[model samples]
Target: MTVPDSLADADGLATFAVATVLGFEDFGADAVVEAVRKSLPELADEYGEQVFAQLSSALRGAEGDGASPWSRRTRWPSLEDRVQRMERVEYAQLCRVRDALTLLVEASPALALARRAGVENSDVRHIEAVRALNRRTDEYLRRAEAVSRYPAERAWKGFTGLLLHVCSSPGRLSTFQQDVTVLDPALNDVPGLGRRVLARCMAASDGEA
Candidate 1:
């Protein structure tokens, strides 16, 4: 089903490979093949486990030498090759994080808050470090604002504006540990805000409301 990366595309071969690798004895290969044919374009170059998960099926199918199309799936094991691939994946993750942080910085209250908090030299230096990673975020925001004509667009000359603000020091990170985490399930795993208590601490700084 995959656009015949090679000439010997065989029916059910891709699916059969998947089922065998999955250890499903009677899994129908034809069904899997159709699904792969429809989805391979998106999944083919996907990162990390996604690629290997799909490969598992093809790998299973290829176990027995045959004209099966699954036999044609790519294989990789060289240490140097894996290292390069890992670097690309890490690069992508970094971009996503930087973009999200930039998006946060471009918002107003966060900017005002950071500006007020970042008066000192130490704070100024920390903000600079964070900005180094946010160059792309500025670009995305510009394109977004130009198309939509939002007021925030007027504020952000570039990502550096946001980066410089966020790079300011976090105001002496507390070393004390606390059990408090998230009260809301939706916000779990979010970084930087290490604990839910930071919200309460911020509220106290602002005086009740």
Candidate 2:
């Protein structure tokens, strides 16, 4: 099976959300709550409370109407709101809020897959854009030193890294793609690397060796 293309892909995100919910139904909500709490202690007085409330609600796994946890429409508004609010807050405050939110999203399938692939929370903390998720995926593989010349393994590692680097860092994408061109000719433009990588992660998470 293949992984989802991106977190923004509605179907992909939805599938991930469902998979995550089914997989981690037993997870305590306390971690989510604590992430917010630990982050808030250092926020500037003016915006700390507001950011806390927004993040808390977003991570609570329930909508205002008591529906599902991460309906794209419901979750984005809250996340977007926090993002916009952070712009007006102090730098430290913004960092804290971002950290808290990032931690919460880790419970989602998108980041969960990264974790399953062996990425730690710290690995994703520096993501500045949505594309960073893909970049981080590549980093996970690279850190594992799992890149190989075999068709399946090399295509999986190098190509996924290429896709991620291209998505997250567009300016550097050209150079990276060129580098990848020298490495794996088969993965020129499949457009399904994300899905493929995600599938690999799912398998790994299920303890498949």
Candidate 3:
């Protein structure tokens, strides 16, 4: 099946759920956000803009019950409404991602990949949800990395900075851990690269514990 149809495509959904979780566990939310942001380009302008708006706006909405992207999931929220709901949606989505990531870290890779596919909806472009996302993420990372003229430090920081911001949360370490595993270690600016995210998650867990 084509990329758009892959949302309902069983194989594609399965892979995405696993991979998204895998990405979260290993890479963190900023990385996941980076990955999702990277994938957003494939969403087409209107929806892409709306979705991205929701992602950012929603993250902010978490400051209050001000209706975030997920909260705005009425039959069809307007672009503005979707933007309002972004924070709630982000919270829910991030939690789901964390749960998924936590599972991958705990279980075998085969089991992680074998779970049943969730009911993933296609984005405005109508590609299978996860497939479309994964496609865009890979493309974004590649495009960002293809800066031939930029110095090595600039190029590397460009991508890593994106990962750190988008994936960061109060105390979620999984995303950070996974990201550093893949990031260039030569750069020293990011001491204990994922430390901030790790600290955030560790603090949360400690509070709960």
The runs of at least 3 residues in candidate 3 whose Cα sits more than 4 Å from the true structure, single-residue gaps closed, are: 1-16, 19-28, 48-50, 57-209
Model 1 ranges off by over 4 Å: 1-25, 35-42, 47-79, 85-97, 101-209
Window of ten residues with lowest summed lDDT in model 1: 171-180
Estimate, for each residue in 1-209, the C-alpha lDDT of model 2 and write its tens digit.
33443443444345444545653233334444343344323232323355455544654555333555444222222455544543545565334433322322222344435545764332233321223534433433342233332356564565454333233332332243333232232233223433554666767678865
Which one wins on TM-score? Answer: 2
TM-score of 2: 0.24
What is the lDDT, from 0 to 100, of the residue 59 in candidate 2?
A: 45
Of the candidates numbered 1 and 2, which has the greater TM-score value? 2
Regarding lDDT, does 2 or 3 come out ahead? Answer: 2
How well is each residue in 141-190 modelled by candidate 3, as lDDT tens digits? 33333432357788556544433323342222233343322322212222
TM-score of 3: 0.21
Per-candidate local distance difference test: 0.39, 0.39, 0.37
State TM-scores per candidate: 0.22, 0.24, 0.21
Best by lDDT: 2
Question: lDDT-based ranking, best first?
Answer: 2, 1, 3
